[model samples]
Target chain A: MVNWQLYLLMFLPLAFVIVFNYVPMYGLLMAFQNFDPILGIWHSQWVGFQNFQQWFHNYQFWPLIKNTIALQLFGLVVGFPVPIILAIMLHEVANDKIRRFMQTVLYAPYFISTVVIVGMLFIFVDPQTGLVNHLIVSLGGKPIFFMASPRWFRPLYVFSGVWQGAGFGTILYLAALTGVSPDLLDAALIDGASRMRRIWHISLPTIRPIVIIMLIWSIGDIMAVGPDKAYLMQTPLNLSASQIIPTYVYETGLLNAQYSFGAVVGLFNSVINSVLLIIVNFIAKRLTETSIF
Target chain B: MEWIRKLPKRSTKGDMVFDIVNLGLLLIVCLIVLYPLYFVLIASFSDPTQVNLGHVWLWTRHFTLEGYKVLFATGSIWRGFVNSLLYCALSVAISVPLTIMAAYPLSRKDFVGRHVITVILTVTLLFSGGLIPTYMLVRSLGMVNTIWALILPGAVGAWNIIVARTFFQTSIPNELLEAAKMDGCSDIRFLIQIVIPLSKPMIAVMTLWVVVGQWNSYFPAMIYLNNTSLYPLQLVLYQILVQNQSSIGITSSPESMAAQQHLAELIQYTAIIVSTIPLLVLYPFLQKYFVKGVTVGSLKG
Candidate 1:
């Protein structure tokens, strides 16, 4: 017999998803309509692909795509492996007390607000007056404008992200690593395998599935370069380097009130992210025999 | 013979060297993580001129609580802090119970629509309507610029639901639930009496995750909140950190030049430190739970 209580309990979460997530997808038609509040979606004029073209032809359009893709690629290239290495290192830590302490400290930055992290960066990189510059000058080196310089922005963003996030990211792999049989490790040890060899030959292969799943998930979120961190960092000083698709969308839609154009740009970004995720998932499934699906 | 030859002597010099190098690298990683936080704390106490000159690092050269004095002087900062606390508390209260209930049914393999429910939730994690649609929905609900916009829109994240459900399925045995059912315990009764008691670690972990997510959150506050008064601590602190010069409101002062200069260097760093401290204080108590929660959540279903 079907339980009525189950239905009652499920109501709130189900209702919330439908109301908030599914319903607003109707708003995506705002990209097509000259979406007026008074007329609403059904009555608004269908300009079709005009809004999408507006984003495509904008002077800054290619740069936005370039910046967004480059940053995502940079994050994946530099950041994708650190957590795996960290998980391995953490797994090797003989003492639970120090391992736990290190994990706690490593994750401290992840809990810090993004704005705060960027702020800490600003302090760290202050040219003549920054701590980094002071250290450089004290040791006889030139001060550099780390935030203002275009070249440094991506590295700073990606590295700081790794430092902040790698620990938290390792949690999953470590969990998977725990499922590896101790007997297997003992066998490897008896065969004269060093810790590094055991990790490479045994520990790694076991956790490979979890790693691929996470990588796929991360790639799916690639286009979602957070607007807050990028936006907050984009002073006139760093504007050229920091300008990306999300910020462009925000400026076009919210700041300049080009709602249609902004929606089109955002929709385009989402489409690109979705396509990349699918492609990567296909590749991963082919290569590793693992998929998010 | 090959295995015996391949085996290195225990506690060899090469192994000791590798261990030392590894330990050193780990220490450096810890220092890199820790120093930014330490520097900010010290700089907030140090003289602004000294801080600007990069004199403050490990300790404040001129220790004063002046930055805190100035930070707390503004009524707006305190108001934002309270709003943030209220928002986090309310969201946790709503989210924790909702998640438990939603997760409980899904955890049961015998639940009629378990796979369907799981697929429905997981799909959202992989794809969403993106920001604009979500915002439009919030606006349509008349929740824009309200605390409800913050809480109700994100009551149940798909990732968290999966995590909670995984915790339940793995940790809570079906035998226990069946026994409870045999004793004539209803679903709600079993949830309250059996599931909750056994699920304390997961609950603690989930609460910590949700609470941290809420507290450190700035983006939703930035978008949904039109009223400056409704702005959370992170948003206000973000404003301070972003527009380093503008935050001080330094007009018509006898010491205008010095105050302006001091305000620039100290405020950003100080604001960051202030924003981070509250959550860090709560971390040690919750760290074990967080690790456990993350571990459980990350395991593939």
Candidate 2:
């Protein structure tokens, strides 16, 4: 109630954010320095854009960028619509109990840890013993080593991601759909409008702002493909296709202790993300007249 | 069945087609989502050799408890499980309270600088200091390899704060605050006695989000803590899954080696089940809250 009491309440959490989040922005300066942990951030020698230049010239740069963008586009194409589709189909289900049952079943996977999902991938795709390969071998087909092969990398990563995330995404869309006023749908039904026609005309229109916001949100994070799963899935065999910017940053900075180079790569990754968010938000606002900002 | 028959006889042919197609598509989706989990459960019970040989399908063949025996025999699994439990419980305790504190003040209309603070917090979501620097900062804090490292850096999330704040603002009306203030009740007392009781649903939802998140978390553990004893279940599972050859510690006795390999395969399935069972058990009870979780406090899109 009082200003001082309010200030006290806000203190620690604000301090936590400032220290954990903003202080790291200060650490971004390490990208421009030949950062030595021994020398510390302040004492480290500044190298300006040299690390950035080296990264740009590196052979892995193009592949890393290409792989990252490709994965995002792939996800946007396939993963984005999946929940929308799920929500719509679930909406169409006339039986309430059946709709709820299917949703509960689907939401189960969303809570499965990313590590577990990849672990599931391992068991399902093991060349000699996995289920898919086993099925293939039984059907008189060659067993493909899905994990070890470079070509299968993106497909495995993206599809497994969709499998894990689509159910969770359906929640918000379903919320939006269920929140839609029934009067509109009832009017359409009385007019002899077919289910498909009503959905196309009413349901889709009602959720378009949400769809745009979600789309823009996903686009804004295009540069932030967490290296966790890809890093987990990475092996020498699949390195060519699986190597993306985040993993590269992890390896260069932490594994190899190339802190400056890692920082350079990280800064580059973040800059691209910020720029993309701005551009996408601008485009979304122009087209949809609704933006998160 | 009766409900279907009760529908009007004039129901369109297109609607029939739509129902059939929709049901069919939904069934496929359910199968795709469910079969892998089903396979894991069945495989965990089956003989490791049967599983490794690709002989088990549709049902458990050579059913055995050998995988569970081996997994329980491993000391690291128990240690990791305990460590994970501690991390999860403590982190939620720390985080939920902090999120409430941060959220409450921001929810207040009279709180000066709320806009600036929100913008600063929101900007952190869009751009962060990148992983390396953040890691460096953690290391400098002398938190590397400490439980504090796991708990401190992410004690509260800004998004959670926003959600909680939204809940507080909408649900705890300004008039209630005014009435409490008129009675000379201190802000802390009012919050503790009134705001918290009314905000239980939001708190519960946020707790579910944080608990599940903390339970499943391994990345920070992977980076910050190197001690084997400190490893959470997921990190330990990561070892068993990704780099199992070492984690299994293959011995050189040929007979023992052959048996260990067979056991190792089934143990893999057991590890996944054992680690995830707590979450799976909690899911049914918490699921209703998750719906409330997504819908509430989220400024309706």
* Chain B TM-score list for all models: 0.91, 0.94
Q: Candidate 2 recovers what fraction of true contacts? A: 0.72
lDDT of 2 at B34: 90
Instruction: For residues A1-293, write the lDDT of model 1, one tens digit per residue.
Output: 54667767878987777776677666788898776655766787889888877777888888888888898889998999998988887777656777778878877777887878887777678787778888888899898888888788888888878878877777777778888898997787577666677788998999887787777777777886768778877767767778998888788776676667777888888788778777877887887675655
List runs of model 2 lying over 4 Å from the truth. Answer: B3-10, B246-250, B297-301
lDDT (10s digit) by residue, model 2, range A1-293: 35678889889999999999999999999989999988889899999899989999999989999989998888888899999999998887878778888888888888888888898899889999888998899899999989889899988988998998898788888888876778987777788888799889988987887888888878887887888888989988999888889999998889999999998898899989988988887888898776655
Return the interface RMSD of model 1.
4.4
Residue B298 alpha-carbon offset, candidate 1, angstroms? 2.1
lDDT of 2 by residue, B220-282 (tens): 889888899899888988988877642565588999888777776778899999987888778
User: DockQ, per-model, please?
Assistant: 0.48, 0.70
The TM-scores, one per candidate, come to 0.92, 0.97
